[model samples]
Target: MTILKAMVLYKQEPIENNPLIYSDIDKPEPGHGEVLLRIRCCGVCRTDLHIAEGDLRPIKLPIIPGHQVVATVEEVGEGVQEVRKGDRVGVPWLYWSCGRCKYCRRGLENLCDNALFTGYSVDGGYAEYMVAKADFVHPIPGFFDDRHAAPLLCGGAIGYRALRLTGLLERGEGSLGLFGFGSSAHMIIQVAINKGLDVYVFTRGEQRQEHALQLGAKWAGKPTDESPIKLDAAIVFAPAGWVFIEALKKLDKGGRVVLAGIYMSPVEKLEYSLLWLEREVKSVANVTREDVREFLKEAAQAGVRTEITIYDLKDANKALQDLKHGKLKGSAVLKII
Candidate 1:
């Protein structure tokens, strides 16, 4: 058996004391319709932080934690055509879905009941080698480097899905509001600006607001204050429910609000008038394969930029800690040999 070095999370705890242990494990093999990838870079997302801190339970112990992966194909199994040896590919959070399910038949694979996640359900890209289903991997654009493409796998793709859910793609001119200025929201602002929409950003901290303006947001302010102009549509990326209420109040009539984050604090009771004014509130769930393909095509053309801080694979725990405490400005990435 061939051995490979990998960072394994054995128990849920704070990442400070190195909750993730480095060890030598047997390298995985490519089964039928699978490919073994040599991981280059993997983006550290907020969901990884949640898994490290034990907030999102359900993952089996002694697992590798990483999802947004960019890698090169090292080997391929039988019946693999989408990728071959030396091909650069991207592995996203959604790993596999049962094809015969009702949701999968309708092209809504993200909603498939038998879905498996990359890092959560199986060993993922935190190691030098990992195996993924060939059909699910996406081809990285030629213009992007490994580090640049890693963030796009999750943040850029999911942000694009949230933006599309808002109905802002068809509207040529309107005020678009982003309720947070993190990795995902930053990408969304760029896509919105590229489409000729005026972008407004609401986030805490003066530094975040300034960063938002630097990224082409026409106006940047705290959620406590009112916007200069009412927004035609808004996407809330903050994990605070109060921010959701604030965004609804800033929307124009018939405006839609897309809740992009997976977890949020409990919302306090609010008056029904907030939703009574034809203001729609919709949640963005897991993304479909179509969402991934469309976003990659647009990202290749729109030239979306990612602000990232790179760390060694051994320091994944540190990266998660910094992300949990909001120490980094943009996205964090872990580089594997």
Candidate 2:
């Protein structure tokens, strides 16, 4: 058995106080249908921040916190056919789903009752090596490098899923509004442009607005500011409650607004008139593997771009701190081995 160095979080605490310790652990071996991967990069998501701060309780202690992983297969277990040794792959938040569930039977595995989440429910990619079910690993597109593709596994894929939840993919010539200009919104903006839809962004900070504009958003303004045109669909990535109301107010008749974050401030008060015009609000949960496949293909073709700040694997805590404080412009990634 080989020993590998990894950053392990034994307890939930602020990142600044050495919440995660760098230690040696036995490298995980491929299981019955799993593949051992030599992790190269892992993206730090807001969910990770939540877990670290105890906002989301840890499913297991001494866990390695990461899911948006890019790695190369080092070994393959029996019964694995989709991936081979030395193949580059990406691991997402959805680790596995019970195929016997009604949701899985209906090809809606994202809602599976027995779904397992990487990093959340199992050991994840915050190490030199990790293992995953071969069928769950997605092939990285040739156009993206490991660091660049890391964020796409979760932020990009889930954002794409949120967009799909809006039913915008089937609709034509509809205005799309993104209620936050984070990494996900950046990718979504490009996709909207490729689909020939106008893009509007609502965010509080000036920097995010500039980023939205740079990504070809037709209009960008603070949440308090109003858009000149109503939106056919909107996606809210910000966890702030007020943004949701602002986005709802900007929706056209029969429009939809998808809430993309895992947790958000409570919607204390909302006027029914805002939703009385046949407008609807939907929430996006964990993504299906099919969503991963489709989003990666479309992202590759749309020339989706990611803005990332890189940190060494041992600096995973720093990455989380930066993400928590909103110091990074886009996504924060930790380069392992």
Ten-residue segment with the worst summed lDDT in candidate 1?
A: 52-61
Clashing pairs in 2: none
Residue 143 of candidate 1: its Cα lDDT? 72
Instruction: Please give the lDDT score at residue 144 for candidate 1.
Output: 81
Please write out the lDDT profile of model 2 over residues 155-254, one tens digit for every residue: 9999999988888788757789899888898888888788777889998889788888888988899877978798899999998888999999999999
What's the C-alpha lDDT at position 322 in model 2?
A: 85
For lDDT, the strongest prediction is: 2
Clashes of each: 0, 0
Deviation (Å) of 275 in candidate 2: 1.2
